[model samples]
Target: MKHINLLLLLIVTTITIVLLWQGAQTREKESQLLEVISRHSKASDPSKSSDLTRNSAPGGAARPSAAAFEPDHFLTELNSLLDSAGTDSRTVQRAMRMFLFDNKGKLASASPKALKEACNKIEADWATDAKSFVWLELVSEIVKSDPAWAIRNIDRFLMTIAKEQPMEKMLHYLGKNGRLGDPAWSPEYAAELEKWFDTAEADGRLKGMDEEAAGMRFDLNISLGNLLGAVEQLTHLPEDSLSTRLEDLAASSSAPSGQRGLVEAVAAAVPATDFQDFTRALSQHAGFDSARELLARAELTAERHDLAAAGIAAADIGPQTAARADWLITTLRDKDAGAVTGFAAAWTQAAHKDTAAWLTSLPAGDARDAAVAGFAPAIARLDGATAAKWGLTLENPSLRTSVMDHVYREWHQQEPEAAAEYFGR
Candidate 1:
């Protein structure tokens, strides 16, 4: 009987040890499960209670399961929790990004109307979250399939949102990738876009916009490359306001010389009869020096176009027939000295006298020297004796030498013996 009792005690001890081991194992598993639940709860809802530890399982189930951790369901629950009252903007945005990432494939495959509805829901839910850009993210996705709808709603979104962040984002997207010039643009859509710009400008939002946005607006609307569109926009602005804005735009250091394009576009848009007045205003607003440069470029472009169409030689084009007096002077100064001289001599006698007077009256500078050199060869070819007398009046020694060399070459070419005899003196 004692032996039997000993065996029974051994069996009882074995059973006790087994029960303890299993209990420890179950406790360890519970600890691990609680860790994961704690992490997920904190991530999805920071305000969740420490009492969750008593439940011993995640998702309020008897045990953790694969379904409890599915990313889509997890994100959906997290989003629902985040949408609750008192949730901060940072948390909402984080949750929104996660939701988007998890559902991106499904969203991409959805119909445009469905995609738009999802975006509207996000906007409605997060409208109070000042720092949230989830709506923009949604719009970006929506734009890939339905750009027109996205664009039409952008202004509406801007109107509903208090912050400039959304507007800036929309502008940035529009400016990037030539979205403004999208081939899908319709007349109604174009009008809507124009109206938006008008409102933005009137509200001073355009003025306060970032430099890139401002540049894109001007580039899309008022650039000379888009002459018709540019002119239409310009005509809508008051004259004084337009002049002021143009001056400011022209002063940008990034494109100082490029302002000439703006000037030319404006000039082309206006009636020819009003061009003088327009130029005068431009000179007053942009400064005389800048105005002159712009006008010169404009005249050069027009003349070149005219010449090309008329099949006229540039060399044969005379100052008298040119649109601007300065064009002729500039052309003469640019040509080779010999050509200039020949052209001056070949001019009508009245023109030759006018050219001579103009050259003499020029201030003593490289320009004056170039003009003197240009006229010397022609004068010598026409009458070497007279050119020799005029050579004495040259102030720069190098210029004087250049004039004499040209005169000698021309005179030699025309009458070698007489040129030799004249130089021999």
Candidate 2:
């Protein structure tokens, strides 16, 4: 009987402990749920409006209120309400802020020391209660007003930011406000910022950054190339490296021909004085135009005494692309009327796509248009329908319109009645 009683007592104790533990967990969960509900309920509660404003002011401080800010109260006994809600930090913060705004007289009465203490508490608790950006704003205001506390704790508090999404918001706030460049800029901080920037740039996800938040803080605060140190840490690239890591990627020959433009553009923008040699050495596939551009830069100008290299550059232009951007100028001044029509045919085919891109990419002026227009007769043969559609997407709208009108005239000479249907009513 004694053994059985002892065993029963042990079992009862264990059951009681388990019940208590579960009850405690239930209470904790309930409390957390209530906290969330309280946040939303307070936000929507019309009565909290005045409270929110007063506390949001720069120096709004909490004070002894004339009456308890309404919160749920539980009755302890007759004529006694247990003050379940009075003086909670969040409640106090909102009410004090609202009261301060509603009556500056109340704010004026707050002692400076008290105000500072209240601000510190509210700011310290912000990361737990407010949005992450809210904490940034709170810290920023705190740092601006109370650099003493910030200088001491900013590092510790900032770790909370890394866990948040859209970390750029926090980074931008710090970077733009000059905090990123502060004496606190450690090697670890710089390395992380560079990693984030390179990742964002690589993924093409850098668009969310506002113009003011464009560059990393180090980029703004340090010398232009100083951020190179962090990038160097990544891959220990060459001393004169200018190309991004992506420049190394090559497309397989089986890829679509349309992808050629993107590949060529990336390769051209890459930093390589000897790109023609490097690319040819790397793969069976390479863009001849890009190769020619590299070699052309090595050509000597008459001014530079490298004129020997100019002919070399011209030769490298690969018969396909160099199809004569050269003398066609004086040629199209084609003083020969019969040769004019023939020249037009060749020019139209070469200049079909990105014609305006080519024209504008050159030195600007009416001169270029006049020269390119000499090929207009060629363009006419290329597209009668496109010529008719000119009013829509023409470059140099006025000049193109006139050119179209002239082409119409020429077409009229060839077949006047047929041309009327194109250019005329």
Candidate 3:
């Protein structure tokens, strides 16, 4: 029993000694870490060292010694702390926070070189497992002081850990609607940004930023007065939101120095392919009367004339859409009644089934009859027998006879016997 008790006592003594040694090591490590942080804090503000020295002089208040701001020395100690084994995340985060941010999480006025070096070191060592919020915040702050440098370096930070917050911040800083007190946006700057967006999109950093990119492009084109380009961007946006943006354009365009009357002018100037987008948006955004007024006031070349008529025809034909169509047919009948034929051709070329459905939905009367009259000619161009049969379905007897007679005359010119036989039947 005596031997067993002694053996137990020995075991306890060994364990106690080991624990004391470990406690002492922990305290020593903690002390070293605190000293490093103290030095870093002092370096962030060089005035602290001067204040200490001044206070230590004659007739000065007594003060503690402060280490001078030494980028090289401080970095060495910082790297050493990070290199030590068993360093926890809390320790690393606290250390980096002290090095990069003040009490309010704002960046300190550290030299750019030191800031960059320290950030690079932290990102290299500590960012292997997770993205660093502290690092991203630092970049956001940097964007204010040197946007160009931030813009150039941001992609590097995002290579492995792409983040949307910082990317958007960088873009917003350069966009025209930037925060108040920013430098006025210049067209040259916009042009440069256009190139950057193009490359960033190609590289995939701009993935999922379609709406934002479109908005920026719209603003850039506005600054450059590329009306067609600006209007083109609107097509990518939500249909419901187009009215407000169009209103913005109209408000500005009403000014004497604004692009007033140019909307109509550009309609005739640009190619049909380009002007189609403008007319589509215009027809959908404005009510029927508004669309009619705008189109009526404009001087459209032949290329766009039919497209404009088609845009109205394809738009939502409520009372408003119906009114616009009637007004176009009645008002322009003497001058360009052939526009309706073109409208029918364009609509049918894309979706004949939809054209048939639209014609069916029209109220029974002159409107439906006139629309059918327009469609008959275009359909005859496709299949004259089919068009003559379609004209026979019309309710107005005289109108039906007239339309069928016209189809008969055209068909006779192509297939005389077939036309006579079909009409006779």
Candidate 4:
């Protein structure tokens, strides 16, 4: 009887532990389900909350699944919403956004044939102006999935543009839906797009739209991720319109690396005479890190390095600027200090008399302070007394001290007597 009791107790304990483990697993799954629902719900409608809760298992029924969020269920629901009379277009859009955000992975899984079929069905069912947006929205998502198909079926999108819509509106649709700026794009896709644009122009789709066509080409080349090709296209635009467009491009998020490609392209293409204005525009729009990146990547020929140095000298290097500028300085100093020194030397060379005169004429301000900080050490090594005198002119006292200390050390190493005499005064 005692042996029987011990066996029964062991069985009961084992059953209890199994039940507890299953209960913990259920709770964890429920938590995950709630999180996914909550996230998609917020994206769908900020005002509404998800009603999806963990249903109690009856007779050991299977757990809740995300089958409702899958494409088959969503497509059926989308069609139902579309068929329902008096359904606000916004409702459909919100559903689509939520579905796309949650199941964006579907882009990879959904076969191109399925996508093409969906696009065909949507085109066949084109019934009302209200439902027109559905075609474009799906096309945008499709472009994200299969860009080559999107390019081949480009006219399906172009035809949707109303004749009354302004060229800007058409451009916006192309930009947003074409996914032209998506970084995942390949060079071959870009070349194909370039050919398509050329064909469009030759076939009269872009007739009498030279300026707009050029703008689109610039954007496409930028999308190509080829800095030189994008820069080369800039020359095709009207001179008067180029600066405004370049500024817009510099400020645009449409480039692969955001503004970095446009920055590099423009830096390479700009005439040495206009670098200061270009740098300032970049500083105002993109920030100093872009300028540093441009400098870092430049081939640094005599003309190029001197022009870039002058531009960097004139632009804002304030505490309010990106902290990455300091990081860049420290990093460059650690890895390749000679490059910075060589750049400063080239800028101060007699061949760059105009650049030197411009620097000299600048009043004491952030530009001057930056210039002093950048060039003082090189000047110290070249002419110790002159560099020591130049470092004292900086407006930021801490910056002044820091630059002066560096300058003095170099100067002292070069000419200790001159450095001592200069500081003693």
Candidate 5:
């Protein structure tokens, strides 16, 4: 009778423990919709939130599963709303804005004819009010539903234009639905664009309307990067001769400087034997110009058995190497060739010498910061042989806590036993 009571008590305790654990899990798994859907049918950007917790200083707010925010629900609601509408353009425009906010090809089964009719309906009835927008949604639909139509209608729907016209936004979409769809630009359109550029150069938005001009220039700056990226894809510039066009782009005064900077960064990705040449080319940006490129170079150098060169290159990359660490530990591994001491020392110096300065130089933005924070954990996850080699080769005691914590916290939940072994728990 006493034994039965003991078993019963144990069973009750186990059930209580399991129930508590499940409750905590459920709490952690908040419904993403109830949390942030200003309404049931639109994707309110988390960026709009005034709450500091939503945009925490570091490590980011814990994300609920991204998949939980289903576009299908919004699309279903949109279709039902559209079906009941009474030929109202404002109503149609509102529906389109909702559709665009959750743009993920939800109604992908609709045919090309249906898409054309949809585009026509939106174009004819799109609202002139600042209170709502449907053009971006319509443009996104045309782009995905039919790239050919996107190409054909490129002139009709560009979001930005140098000058305001009664229907320029619609025409902009028709021209570059996907990149100057009509390869042969009408001479008249070319002349118009040229005239716009001349106005930008002469009266110059700087003197005429500085604020609006600056905004327009900012938009133009972004467009040029995509334009050049598209051009590169279409041309498929050979690996060896990649820099020629890039050089041309940088030297062209009309080439947007921001776009040129991006082009310079991408060109640095081309694999090559001469580290010196690649480093020299990318250093022009003044924005820790060599961080990502040098990180890549360090990997290549370690692979080539040029340990001294790799170390020097890593040092040149400075502290930002720790943040630009897309693959620092992997870069150091260099196959199963075991560890190279020089590469390890170089990396330690680059990361530890000026920790704050190095963090400062890395890419800006929340995602970049999180990766920077994880740099140590990344190094901790190195294979056993490499980790041991790394331990013996370096002497930075300050770094151990971060590296160990990164590994233990990361691996513990997923593989607790292995994580215990990793942290020597």
Candidate 6:
């Protein structure tokens, strides 16, 4: 009997110790949960509630009721928790998005004023510039459903911390949605955008950028193509003002060559009646190199071919002609060899006052021989006997043979009997 009582007492003592340890662990878990709830409640309240209102037990700590676990309350507490924990901005943003997704039904039913207030809260709490931009984007989306709100806030807070990306995205969105030209939103929005571009250009903000980057930043191709289109559609600005603005944009040397090319192409598209004045304006404002390049490009155009020929004929034999001589030669080579010979003869006559003297002064090589060959046909056509005499004077054997063959062909075709007697001699 004594052994049995001692064993039972030992078992009882062990059970008591285990129970006490379990109780302590349970209390510790409860304390941790309460602390979490307290922090959550504090973070959720803007004023930070000091009073710990909870269901208290006799001689025990306060405990939260099921009321605190309501869906809306839980989301608020979670948001507050995330914000106060100094979580990364993107992480917080994602978490908030998830919360919205989970409670999308509630959000859908929420009033506009409530939604705006919530967006304002998000804007105020988020730390990063990216978060602020996201808030604005959200606002834009929300206001799209409310046209009155959109009109009121379209220009307000339109800018983002990122230099141009947000505005560009917004503009693209507006254009894609056909809201940019909406009469209900007022034409002032488009005007505001134009003014912004003008201001940026004047401030040199768009200057000195690399070609590809500047093209993207300024929407160079799209803007230039649509410049007149905008004036016609928007009607907020005069055509003359827009034209002057385009001229200013084109003349900026800091802009890329492609931009200048677009300007030159537009000028070339002008009617013949206005072409002279257009070119004159370009020359006055776009500098000498640009003017020269514009003229060269214009000369290459199909419509200006005759004009190009006339201009080349009238052009003096100077540095300008020399500079353009290669292009002119290449252009004329495929069209008419006679014209090429005539141009060369003209250049020589102007420079040296004698084509034969210019030909003799040329260096002895294939280049000079080619020049002789090029001029031979024209010379033969003019006077075959004189051409044959000049052919014998050529130092290059190949050139002499080629010129003689050409002269004989012409002399034979023109006067075979005289050619037969001259050959027999």
Name the best candidate (by TM-score).
4
Better of 2 and 6 by lDDT: 6
Evaluation by TM-score, superior candidate among 1 and 3: 3
lDDT of 1 by residue, 69-114 (tens): 2323433444444544134444344444534443344554556666
Residue range 236-295, candidate 3, lDDT tens digits: 666555555554444334233323254555454444544454555555656445665666
Better of 1 and 5 by TM-score: 1
Model 1 residue 130 CA deviation in Å: 8.3
lDDT of 4 by residue, 334-425 (tens): 22232333333435553233334445765665545665566677667778877777778877889889988998898888788878888883
Residue-level lDDT tens digits of model 2 in 341-371: 2223344455555443344443534435553
For residue 415, give model 3's deviation from the true position in Å: 27
Residue runs of model 4 more than 4 Å from their true location after superposition: 1-76, 85-108, 160-170, 176-185, 207-215, 223-226, 235-273, 276-309, 312-425
TM per prediction: 0.36, 0.26, 0.38, 0.43, 0.26, 0.29
Model 5 spans with C-alpha error above 4 angstroms: 1-96, 99-106, 126-132, 158-425
Per-residue accuracy of model 6 over 1-425 as CA lDDT, tens digit each = 99999999999999999999989976665454445445555554434344433322223243333222233454355555455434455444544443333334444455566556666665555554544533444444455355445433443445533345544444544442343333233334444444544555586554443232232323332344443332222123333443543443444433334434544444444443233333334445654455555555552444344233323432445555554444544444233233334445445445522445556656664445545564555565556676677667766776577777877787777878776676663
In terms of lDDT, the best-performing candidate is 3
Q: Taking the tens digit of each residue's C-alpha lDDT, what string does model 5 give over 1-425?
A: 99999999999999999999988755543232223223333233443344423332234463322233233343344445455443556544544443343433333444556556555654555444321243344444545544545543543343232235413343343333323322333333333433454454584332544333333332233344333432333133344553543333333323333443443344344443332233333343322333434433432434443332233234445545554333433344444322223333335434543433444454543322333343333344443323333333223344444445555665565666776775578
Off by over 4 Å in 3: 1-149, 152-219, 222-274, 309-316, 331-370, 373-388, 391-425
TM-score, model 4 to reference = 0.43
Worst 10 residues of 5 by lDDT: 29-38
Candidate 4, which ten residues in sequence have the lowest lDDT sum?
54-63
Q: How much is the lDDT of residue 301 in candidate 2?
A: 24
Per-residue error (Å), model 2, residue 159: 1.1
Order of quality (lDDT): 3, 4, 1, 6, 5, 2
Each candidate's lDDT (Cα)? 0.51, 0.40, 0.57, 0.55, 0.40, 0.47
